[model samples]
Target: MPRFQYRAADANHRIVKGQIEALHETDLVTQLDRLGLTLVRASVVTKHKRAVKSLTQQELINFLFQMEMLMRAGVPILTALGDMRDTAASTEAQHLSAGLYERIQSGETLAAAMDKYPGIFSEVVVNLVSSGEVTGNLPEVLRELVRALKWQHEIAAQTKKMLMYPAFAMTVIGIVVVFMMMYVVPQLTTFLLSMEQGVPIQTRALIWVSDLFLKYWWALIALPPLLIAGVVALAQANPGVRHFLHFLVLRIPLFGEVLKKIILARLTDTFALMYGTGIPVLDGLGHCRKVSGNLVIQDAIGRVIERIASGTSISSSFAAERLFPVLVIRMLQVGESSGALDESLKNVSYFYTREINESIGKAQAMIQPIITVAMGLILGWIMFAVLSPIYDSLSKMKT
Candidate 1:
């Protein structure tokens, strides 16, 4: 197929310049005329499909939200996309809308139009949209999608909230410790040595540590980050290592419990959305593996999927995994028994979301005070080590 660049005029004789694929200039004219525009001038653009930039999560969410709102207002899909293309603030958005508009205007379904830009839409999103198209409920599906994505965004923000302060406090504490060891402790040790007094054990230990810091300060600071990067790189390259890392991530005490809830909350919400859109439970579970974000969880879901495929109950399949909690299993049992899996999952999602928010709040509160006290203890030890020597010497002199 050949792509052509064309200049056309609509009914009002307004100029239209765009690219379309066709067999010849004759085909271009046919396409333009079909779109209610008469061709003025035409030239070939390209033969190959133009690659599009992958849209970010936020961009996809925004696009879906806009599309849902517009379509719900009775705007035709092509009209909405064309309007968006004309008024788009970014080249990415313009290109996206133009591509979709071209495809859709050329008789492709909206889901099929979106299929041309897989980088901008995930398989789950495409499938949901396809179901919507098939059921003639695209607007409702888009609305559900918007809600699920916003919920995911909120979950991500809450997770970051739990981590932000503790990370900042720890980094500050590390820098303070490094500064004291390299500058303050050494200066005090030198002063104490000049006084020609017997050094206390604490002071000697501090001086030794100061010497080590002075000699290997660069290694002390650089090694941690380097080691972390190496571990991450290695994990990425090796599936087993990546799996183990994810496993460890889910076992990290209170934080792990909170993270598990976050993952489950997202998983259940997405699953429920897909279910409500008329996608099969098995297919929905398959789509969910990608969103789990942890290899451990992904593999567990895979196992659950296999078990379900082998003629097991949904609740049994999930329970056999042993990774899902009592709450999830019990909810699944209820949903399965009552034939309301979507509703049960939604309830789980709601409960988990509330729990996640509360957990984040409690973790934030607990973490701040713990970090503050830990920092205080560290600084106190350094002060006691540096000052105790001077106090002992002064008392001996006075006696």
Candidate 2:
């Protein structure tokens, strides 16, 4: 189906315009007619779509919440979709709702249409919706999705906030340092040289640095992007290098700890969601392996899957891999014993969430002092270099 952008007037004669998807222009016109709207103009919207809007975590959560309410109130899928569509304020949400409506109208399942936008909806979401439709527990599953997405979004927001200040500080400091070396220090050094006296060692060193910077300023400007590109190219060309880079990322001091915890939380959250959908443990782990972005974890999952295939339990396999923290392994063991693995995975998610939050706070606190000290040291060195010659000239005159 293709999406069409259209302008129309409703019963109140108010103009409405938005993107809608359908099989053909006739199908869209029929949809508009059903809505009691007269289409004034419509055209197929086409672009080389490089990406499709996967239902956002927030939008999915909202959809779940609304669907739960509507389903509990005895509303059908089509009716619920329409209600949600008309009520959606954001263009993206409205567009998705419209797409969903058209999909249902065309006799497709919700999950089937959602499959078209993998970026918007994850595999876990598709599976959950499929299960909900099968077990007639769509309302309950939607409620769970709302809870899970909210938790994930909150953690993400905290992580971003924790990083923002240090990143900004580093950028500002870098700009100031570059400016001093390239412009300010060079101009001051010229005046000092004109004094017809030997410059101090500090001044001499500064002059040399300024000259070098002036000569290779373009190199300094181009180095960062070029280095980034080179690294990216190598990573893409070699799986070993890519894995090595990911491993290095996980080992970086403050930021690395937070990142690891965040990834763990996401993984555990997904596992818990799949488990809740009545998926078999081994099958859920298989899907999780496909979705895990970290190669190290994916390798560990490969090993774990092999063990599970050979009749070892989830906890035993996880323990053998040693990929999970002790607490996570213990939780899995308990869940296996109690047959409440979903709840256990949820616990693991919460534990990592707290860890990520604390790690972020600790990282933020450490980064501030470290960045401030670094900036101060760089500025102090430049100042000493620029002022040393002036001080030397003044001393000779006084003598």
Candidate 3:
């Protein structure tokens, strides 16, 4: 969609200027008319050139919290938005709030206005707000949103903590290996070759590797970033490649289990939140599919949706996919029979959350020792290769 900048006049003859996304000028005009404005001028704007920055999660959480408090205190929604816009600390927050205020003032529902900034407000947020709007429970929905956003932030932080150490260790190991192969090994091997004596096979192999590194060290330096970029680009452009990569990640021993737990926790939590908010199950599952972040899981959810549409019970639909654990399936069955599916999903979320935390701790414990041992073995190999020949030469001299 192309963005358009337009100057329009309200019914009271006040000029309004803003940017909106539309398929064409006609669409822009139609949208303006829908907002009760007469378009005076319109021009297509380049989206990339504008570089609109989105608000951070914390900023959005604060905005929601403030809005909830204000609304609870009987402040009007428009007034609350305007105050938030004026008092926002960051430019991104101010931009979002001001844009939202203008749109709301133009008679758009809060959800409809928020739908424009998909980067900041997710489908879940938009749908939940729309539901709240329909149910006359905007303040309560806003509070729930605040809690959900905070939980998401915390989960992200925990995941980072779980992965950071392994990433850092691997980076350090790569640097050390590069340094040895490029510089240290070359110097030592050159000295050994100058000795004019037969070298051991291990020493010869080390020298060959060192020479290769010295000859094409640039490739070593460049390949990692290029490979990473290529993989990311391919993942974004090709769904099959992305799905394969996600599948690979999910099969990666201890780490894979942790990642699965994290994803499951998030999925269940989202499903619970949506279902509890008066959204229908199929609609909630559709939203979950979009936000699942894993193609495999999304596909499974899609299958579940199809099954449910064919008149299968919710639990039976979920069980047909066989992607979920037995416990999850059983809980769903229980929830279905008891008319507390949302509560059951919430319990599933909590179960996965606890599992993720413990798995992360155990993984970190195991990984640290494994990394240490691997590093020790690499150093030991280099030392043995360098020293063994010297000892051999000493033995020859003694003989």
Clash counts per candidate, in order, are 0, 3, 0
Better of 1 and 2 by lDDT: 1
After superposition, the stretches of candidate 2 with alpha carbons farther than 4 Å from their true spots are 1-57, 191-202, 387-399
Error of 3 at 192 (Å): 2.4
Could you say which candidate leads in TM-score?
A: 1
TM-score of every model versus the real structure:
0.86, 0.83, 0.84
Runs in model 1 deviating more than 4 A are: 1-50
**lDDT (Cα) of model 3:** 0.85
Cα RMSD to the true fold for all candidates: 4.1, 4.5, 7.7
Kindly list the per-residue Cα lDDT of model 3 for residues 1-399, writing each as its tens digit.
457899999999999999976545775776688689999998888644233377788888998899899998999997787677656788677667767776787799999999999888888999999999999998998998898789889878887887898899988998898888887987798678766568989888888888888888889779989999999999999988999999998999878888878887888898998898899999999999998888888899999999998899998998888877898899999999999998999888888878888988899889999999999898788888788888887888899
| Candidate 2 global TM-score | 0.83
Please give the CA lDDT of all the candidate structures: 0.85, 0.82, 0.85
Q: After superposition, how far is residue 234 of candidate 2 from its true place, in Å?
A: 2.0
Q: What is the lDDT of residue 267 in candidate 2?
A: 78
Model 1 clash pairs?
A: none
- Model 1 weakest lDDT span, ten residues long: 22-31
